[model samples]
Target: MKRRKFIKKSLIGGAAITMPFVLPSGRLFASSGNRMADHVVFVAFAGGVRQQESVLQRYLDDSQAYPSAGNIMYNILDGAPPTDKIVYGTTNYVNGDTPIPKMLSQTLQQQGTFFKEVNASVVGHYAGVNTLLTGNYMFTQGLRNKPLTPTIFEYLRRLTGEKATKTWFIGNGIGNSIPLLDYSTHSDYGAQYGANFLAPIVTFGNSGDKHLKNAKVYHPEEELDPMYKMKYFLDNVWYSQGSALPNIGNTEEEKLEIKQFVRDMFQKKDNGSIAFPPISDSGDLQTIGYACEVLKRFKPTLTVIYLSNVDGCHGNFSSYLRSLHRADHGVGHLWDFIQNQVPEMSGNTTMIVAPEHGRNDDPNGIKDANAFYGYDHSDSNSQRIFNMMVGPGIDSNLSIGNENNKVGDIVNIAPTIAEILGFKNDIVNTGLLASNQSFFDLI
Candidate 1:
């Protein structure tokens, strides 16, 4: 079948055959409280960022014992760019010498509130993200298992009755148990209230080009009938065995929209029309590009984009610095696209950025090409990170906390998102959160 025709017909009959089923519970009632913003974009500016390099504006001084001290993350923080040992930018004959031009006219710190030093109780990747999404430390949460408590996606969907497509979790790739974060194992809120998840790089990269791009559009009466029977049989078997199949709950209409959006992305990628950042070299930058597409296409009430390129710090500090700089560039592009391209989310959206955790203060004996030592997480220094938010009604050019005084916890992010979307009462009243206070309360 022709690709366009396949998309149209697949929308009509593909739900039954699609794996990881979509079994939407009927929508509840709308939220009652007033919303601070029509939409919220939470960037898990993740991958174990170090406070010295990011928020402290110390480029090499703190990490390498160099006299140089300036910010490489110029788009998010208000500080001058590094003047020496410029190894964190795009290549200009010499490695990483040409910094990507800033995308936002003003830094996010200037446009919103900045939490200089936030506490991240969990230092590991999965646990830190679990804390950020569930608002509970869940120190016992297993690496490969779903979250023990309900995630913010669950609270928002269950309380506000938002559609599956209205909440999204866009991961850079499906590794590190990224695909499992859409929902949780909570009895009260599991797959039925999960967010739609997409690891765009995998979905649109080489594997997808071979498997999903030209998926056959099976005839409904002839081919779909047998597929449906098999699906039902498998689903019944799974259920009878006391196991529930994962369901993202995308309604038929939403599914159609999602498929169409995927098709459009492939075409856009081919034509070089994706809204990629000016320096779309790293995985994080590519992920941010697809994230921009998601926002433009879905206009979701809550969208979480996870970028982990900076995790390279474990082995290559130079690459980590480059990733960190590119991350800031990508974030600037994302915010700029939201404000200028996506009309629906332009003025009414709130953007929040926070790393899941921080890297250690001391080096781990691994040195990069620049003779700089690598850093690992697992100490008091790893608990230190920063959070920032920019949107309507949020104070501009405001900063809270300091080196000696930490202000917010990683767990506060979930409740902060709930508060912004007018579902804080619903989320907090359940008593499942580690702390009910949002960043506003901390302020």
Candidate 2:
């Protein structure tokens, strides 16, 4: 947290890699500060959902020919799913699939607060996520690099003395610099304070099963070839397309604890004891399952899970709707798991859900298998988004803002989370997100 010890440099592969705040004193900060909640789970409900299709229009009836026009997302919003469309993985189907039962008795909005129309900083996927996490709009940020500003994870760890094991970013998949968002390249806060990111599908599915499912330790002198092969595989596949390794920002003991957690997770997966809810086949649902596992095991202080199947909107409108609906279902299951299963984090955790950006108001001229028009986020409508939060310290059943009176910004999110964890001022004092106000303050 000290400003003077910022901006340190290091070398990697004979190239000057500047890693800031490497001093021992820089690793620990104001641990004495008060906290609003014991834990936070941030869902980057990503891949650009259009407001017209989501909070604003509520087009289930119109788009899917349902009997009712109310909310189809029964878990997150106070409404029912499209009873007739039945394409969004509902177990209740007439000729094909039956109606999938509701996951929760109470909706997330009924138990928490809702921001109907939050403003996003940018329309691009990576930039929108960057704004949400960093509390700053990186106008010049490329699609391939990490954010220039420090993320809330770095601020939370550096300002609160939270261990690396207490923070994690469970990604749906590693693409479009999604892995890079776990940390930042800021001078005062970098990998030393980054979150541990894991892509469950890539790490625990087919590739993981091949590479690490039953990985065993090797003796250095006896198995040099095997060791080199393992190292080569890790370097080539794990870091492919500019992806960084699992930059575990932890002490030696904490690192070992994380490794053990991963091993145990693999065992549970193999033994079919994960206790996941009955869910349809979707990447987002799979990611949420792993996220629940992480919560059950580690109960990390800050965990962010990203869902991106909705990006199918770019080429398939029908699939986009299905993905959005399934994403909501997955989210509902995750929240339910936290409340009913994770006893250690049940009542004390806060959950924040928001998309990276909104989709285009018009079609992109692409037709899908269903003959539905495809869309890409581009116009002003793409900038309109929303944020929902439920947990301790947040007002329940409260709705803020509307179409005519739009409030909140993507930048406000990071500061709001910082304030929830009692470090808004500390993060602002660092001059990283000085201009952004906490969403609580805005309301």
CA lDDT of every candidate: 0.91, 0.79
Q: What lDDT does model 2 reach?
A: 0.79
lDDT, residue 300, model 1:
97
RMSD of each: 10.7, 8.9
* Candidate 1 wrongly placed segments (more than 4 Å): 1-29, 218-244
State TM-scores per candidate: 0.90, 0.84
Candidate 1, 1-443: lDDT as tens digits: 69999898888677655543223344344565789999999999999999999999899999999989998998999989989989999998889998888888899999999999999989998888888889999878889999989989999988887889999999999989988888999988999899999999999899988888887655656876788799889888888777676777886568768888988888899999999998899889999999999999999999999999999999999999999999999999999999999999999999999999999989999998889899999999999999999999899999999999999999889999999999888788889999999999999
lDDT of 2 by residue, 148-216 (tens): 988888888888778888888889899978999988888777888889888988988888888887777
lDDT of 1: 0.91
For model 2, the stretches where C-alpha displacement exceeds 4 angstroms are: 1-33, 60-68, 90-99, 217-247
What lDDT is reached at residue 227 by model 1? 84
Candidate 2 clashes between residue pairs 3 or more apart in a chain or in different chains: 72-81, 90-100, 91-98, 91-99, 91-100, 92-98, 92-99, 92-100, 93-98
What local lDDT score does residue 439 receive in model 2, on the 0 to 100 scale? Answer: 75
Candidate 1 versus truth, CA RMSD in Å, comes to 10.7
